[model samples]
Target: MRSRSTLPCCITLLAFALPAQVINKPAQPNKFLEAVGRRAALLGREDGNFEAWVYPIKILRDFQLSVYIDNALEPTPLSGLAETVEVRPGHVTITHVTAAFTVRQTWVASLDKPAVEVLLDIDTSKPLKFRVSFIPEMKPMWPASFGGQSTGWNQKDGVLTFTEGMGRFRPVLGSPRFTRISEQIGHQLPDRTVMIEFEIDRSGRVPIVIAGSRSTYNEIIQDPDALVPAADTFYREFLNRTTSVQAAGLNPSYDWAKIAIEKGWACNDGVGCGLVAGWAPSGLSERPGFGWYFGGDTMMSAWAMQDYGDFAGARAALEFLLDRQRADGKVMHEWTQSSALLDWPKYPYGYYHADTTPLFLFTAARYVRQSGDRDFLQKHWAKLEQAYRFCLTMLDDDGLLSNQKGGAAAVETGALSGKVARDIYLQGVWLGGLAGFADLAGWRGNASLQSEAESRLARAREAIKPWFIQDKGIFAFAQLKDGSRYEANSGWQGFLIANGGIDRALAEKAAASLALPTLATPWGTRMFATDSPFYDPVGYNDGSVWPFVTAQTTLALFRHGQAAAGYRYIYGMAQATGLSGAGFISEYFSGDRFAEGPRAVPHQLFSSVALVHPLISGMLGLDGDAMAGRLTIHPQIPCSLGPVRFERYRVGDAWVSGAIRPAKPTSTVDIEVQGPTLKVVKQPAPCIDLQEVKPLTPGQRGQ
Candidate 1:
C-alpha cells in the first residue's frame, strides 16, 4: 500500500506578483484626478458634480464632515471660495482646537482648478454654521503597490491625504491652542452624503456644524489595531504642515455602492474565478495534459461573482467545461484549453473519477437556469448526454457508481494494485448530477426526459441508502461490492444535502457529524477526521482542510434549516484563515492551524462556489417551479444586516430588483413576478407535479 505521505504534487503559478505596500506621495499636482474627470466629462454632459478619485489602499473617504465658516458681517467673506486652489506640498495641517472646531489650512495654489485638500474641522457642540464653496481636491493613497507601479492616493485617516514616496502630508494648523477631538470610534465609519446650509457669525468664526451628505464607505474595517497605527502616523505627519483652508460642494449624484461592487469584483482572474487570496507559491505551470489546476484556488473564486448576479461569468465556466468534455461523456478531470490531457493524480484513488462528471453537470445546470439561453444548452446537450451516459456506465450491478482503479501510486509503493473501491463522494456527485439534469429537463419542457431522469435519480438514491445507513446515520464513503465502510468522514458528504441530493433529515445528520473536532479545523472543513487511522494532518487528502468542501457543506446545511450553524462554520473559516480580511477565499489551509501554506493556491474556482450559489439557493431560496412556470424564494437573512438587495436578477423571463428582509426569528420570503405573466406561489414545496414544457419548433428540439 502507498503511504499517505506520497501524494501527487498539485501546484499553481500566479500570473502577477503579490501586491506591494503603497507609499503615499507628498502634496503634489493631481494629474490622475484631472485625467479621470476629463474622461468622465467626455463620456457625458459635464454635470459639474461628476467626481473622480483614486485609492491605492482601501479606505472610506466620503464619511464624516467638519465645516468652518467665516462669521464676519461682510457677506463677501465667503466669496471667491468657489475658485479651485491647490495646497502646497508638505504645507497642510489639521489641529483640534475645541469641542466645537479645529484649525486646518494649507498654502493656496495660484493656478486655475489647482489641487487642494479641503478641511472641515467641525465643532460638534455648535448649532449651525457657514456656507463655503470650492472644488475640493481629495487624494487618498494606499500603503501598498501593485508590483512597482506608482502608489496612488487612497483614504488613510478620516481625511483623504496624498503621499509622495516616503513623505507624509495633510492639512496643517498654525495655532497650538487648537484642540483636536479624535473621534474615538472603533471601526472605520461609513461615508454619508448630507446637504447643509450654515450661518456665519459676526466675528467670522463659524459656530454650527450640520450633517449634510451621504455616500457608501467602500473601505472595509476589519481590525482596529491594525488600522489605527497607520491612521495615527498619517495624522501626525499632516499636523506638522499648515497654511490655508477651503471648502468644496458635495456631489450628490455619484453612486459609491456600485463603485464598491465593481472594485470588489475587479480582482477576478480572467479564467472564470477571482483570486480573493494571494497567488499560489508554486507559480503558474500547466499539468502534463491539464492546462491549469489551481486546486481550491480557482474553485473559491466562484462566490465573488454570485452576489453580483454575474450570470455571464457562470456561463463562461460551464461552457469551458462543456467544450472540454471527452468523447466518453466524461469531463476531463482538470484541463486548460492549451492542454489535451487530464490531471487526476491530485486526488488519489480517483483517476478520471465519476465525481468530476457530476460536478460539471451541476455547474451546467446552474448556468442554464440563470441565463435561460436554450442555444447554449442545445450546443452542450450532447456533451451533457454523453457525460450522463458515462456515469450510467459506472453504475455497478447494485446501481451505484464504483471506482475500479485507484489514482497513481507513489513511486515508493512500487506499482499500483488494489481491489476496486466505492467512494461515497462519487455517489453524491451522481445524485447531484441527476438532480441537475432533472432541473434542466424541466426547464427545457421535456416531460418525458424529466420523468426518466426523476426515476433514475430515485433508483440511484434507493440503491445507495442501505449501504450508507449506519447507527450514527450515513456512512461517509462505502465499499464497491460488499458493504465495507470507508473510515474517512468528510465535509463532502454534507454537500450531498446542500446540493439537494438528500432530504433535510439526512443532511442534518451529516452536518452534525461535521462538527466533530476530529474533522473540524480552524481554517475550514478538514478533508478527513484527524482521529481516523488513515489521518495525516499534512497529507494532501488525509487531513488537509479544503475550503471548497467547507463552502459546499456550509451551503447544504444552510439550505436544510441550519443557517446559523452554516454561517458560523463559514465565518469561522473566513476569520481564522484571514480570508475575509483579505477579501477573498483561499483553496485550502493547514489542517492543524489556519496559516496559509507555502504552496497556497489562489484563484480557485470551486472555493467561491459556496459564496455564490448558496446565497441564491440557501439564503434567498430562489428556484423554478417548472410546471407552474413560477419562481419561489424563501429569504432568511441575518439580523445584523440591513435589507439585503439584489440589483439586477433574472427570474424566468423578466429582470427584477428584490430585497430580503428578516422578520425577527422567522425569515421573510418574497418573490416578484418579472417575466411573462406566470403563476407565483407561496408554498415551499418543489414542483414535482409539473410536466416539462417541450420545444415549440424543430430548431428548438433537444435544446
Candidate 2:
C-alpha cells in the first residue's frame, strides 16, 4: 500500500528522533543509463582509464584517456565528490575544482569507432599547461603477457600504434600539436602512462580516432565521420525490433531493455553473427588473458530476443549452437574466438553443461511456436532428437540431471560444491525439455516419438517430486552423490519447476517462503540465502543475485498463482536495472549489498532479457502457437499499474498488440490483431484457496 522506499510501521516506531534537517528525502529517481554514442559499448570511471575493444576482437588493455592541467603532469582521478554528468550523447563534462585551478574536461567517444575524444577547457588567470594523453598498457597483445611485460610506444605518420602478436590498434590524432611526449611501460596504469602535451590554441576542440581495423583506419583517414553510419545502421536495424514496458514513471526497465540487448551483440565479420552472452570483447577476465563464448548464456538470451519479436536475433543465436551441436545432441558450454587453439575441425564442440542441451530443446520448441518455422524445424528435428537422446543418456541413477558428470551449472560455487549428482533445478529443466519435445513430436504427427517423450516426462515428474520436494518443503536446491540434501535457498528453484511444467505446491511454497528475506532482496532474489553456509554474497554462485534468474522466477510465480509476489520480483529487477550502469542491466550483483560484483558484464543479454521475459510472458501472458494457429492471453495485472499496453508484439505469422487495465472491480484485456482474426483464447486466473496455507520457511512446510 506504500511506496517501495517506505519503511514498515514497526521499523519507523523504533527510529531515534532526529532534527528536521536530518530527515531523509525521497531518493532521487535513478534516470536511464544511455550510451555515450548511439551504439558505443564503452564505460569509464573518473580516472582517465577507458576500456574498449573492437567488436569480435578481445579487449584492448591498458589504454586510458588522461589529462594534465597547468604542467603538473598529473591530475587527481575524479574524486567521489566530483559530479560527472552526461552533457550530450557521447559527451560528458567533468569539473573537478580545487585550490589550484578549476578544470573542465569534456569526455567523448565516437559513436561508431573504438575511440575516445576529449578537450580540457581550462579557466585560470595564469599560463596553464594542459595536456591530454592516450596511455597504453606496455605489454604486447599477442601471447598475452599475464607475464606483465613492458614496452615503450612511438608515433609515426601521425598515428600512434600499439601492436602485439594478437592484433593491433592505431590512434589517429587530430588538431593538437604535441609540445611534449613521454611513455611509461608496465602492468599498472601509471606504469603504462603516455603523456602527450599540447599548446592552447584558438579552438581547443581536439579529435582522435582509435582505429580497430584497417578498413576503419582507412575510412577515418579519408573521412573522419565515415564510420558514423555503422552505428546508425545497426541502431536502425534493432530500434524498431522491440517489445517495451513502462509502469508510467515508476520504472525504467523498458528504457534499458533495448540497450542491454544491443550490448550482447557482436560480429566477427565472417565466422557467424548472432547475439552473444555479453560483449566482453575486451578487458581481461578475473583470471586474466582468456575469453570465451558461452552456450548457456546464448540459449537463455535466445528466449529474451524472441520475446522482443526479434525472431531473427533469436533464431540466429539458437542456430549458431545448433550448427555445432555434438553428434550425440550435447550442446556446448563455451568456446574461444580464436578456434585455431581448440582444433575446430576435429574438436569443434566443448560440452560440459547438462542444461544447455535440454535448454536448447526448450528454446527450439519456443522458436517453433513463435515462428512456425517448420522448415527449420524439419531440418533440425534430428538434432533435436539427438539432444533429447543425449539428455536421456546423462540421466543419473537418481533419475535427475547431474552437473558434476555433465557440465558446469548455473551455480558455479558453494557448500554443495562439486559432485556428479543431480541438482534439483536440472530435473525441472529436463522435465520441461521432455514435455516440449513431446509437444513438437505431436505437431509432426509422430505418435511413437511423442509417446516416448511423454513417457520420459511422466517418469521425470514422479522421480523429481520426492528428490526435490520433501519434509513439506517447497523445493530442495540439490542432492549430493551420497543422497544427502542441501536444503538451501536457491533462486533457480522456481525456474526449474516452471520450465518443467510442475505443480502449484512448489510454486505456492516458494512464494510463501520468499515473502520473507531468505531469498528475496530489495533488489531481487539471491542465488543462495545469506544465512546458508553456502552463502557468500560476492561469490559467483554462492550468493550473487542474477536478474535473469529473477526474471525466470518471476514468470514461474505468475503462472503458479503467485502474481503478487511475482510482480515484486519483476519490479525489483526493473529498479535495479539502471542503478550501476544507468541504462545497462549487469551480469550479477553481490549477494550481501546487492551491489555489482567483480567482472560483472554490463548490458548482458540474459540480465536485460530477464526483465523483458517476465513482462511479456507473465504480465501480458501472451502465448502464440503457430502450429496450433492459436493465441492465448491470460492477463493478471495489479491495479496500481494504471493502464498497460503491449504494442506490436508478434506471435508466429500473425501480429497482435493490445492494452489492459483495471476494470470496475477486476482487470480487462483487449487485443488488436493486425491481420484477420484467428482463434483467440482468453483465459482467467485459477482460483487459489488460501484457507489452510500458512507462512513457512523455504526448508519447511506449515498449515
Top TM-score hit: 2
Q: How many clashes show up per model?
A: 74, 10
**Residue range 1-703, candidate 1, lDDT tens digits:** 1101111133221222111222122221211111111001000001111122221121112122234434544323221221222211212222323444433322111111112122333334444343332222222211122221111212222222223333432221111112232222222221232222344332222211111011111121122122223433432332211100010110000011111112222110122322222222111121111114321222233233333345555455455555555667766544332121124334332225456676666666755665566776777677777777777777777666666631211111211124326766667767877888888777667788779878988888877666545575555554634555665576657656666466556667777777666776534567667666566555665666666677776676666655655544544443432132122244556676654433444323344444444545555555643335565666555565434544234443544434455555454434444446545544332211112222122112110
lDDT of 2 at 659: 60
- For all candidates in order, the CA lDDT equals 0.40, 0.59
Which ranges of candidate 2 are over 4 A from the true structure? 1-43, 46-48, 55-82, 87-156, 165-180, 183-191, 225-237, 269-271, 279-291, 340-349, 397-399, 468-470, 505-507, 514-516, 530-533, 684-703
Using all chains and alpha carbons, the TM-scores for the candidates as numbered come to: 0.53, 0.80
So what's the TM-score on candidate 2?
0.80
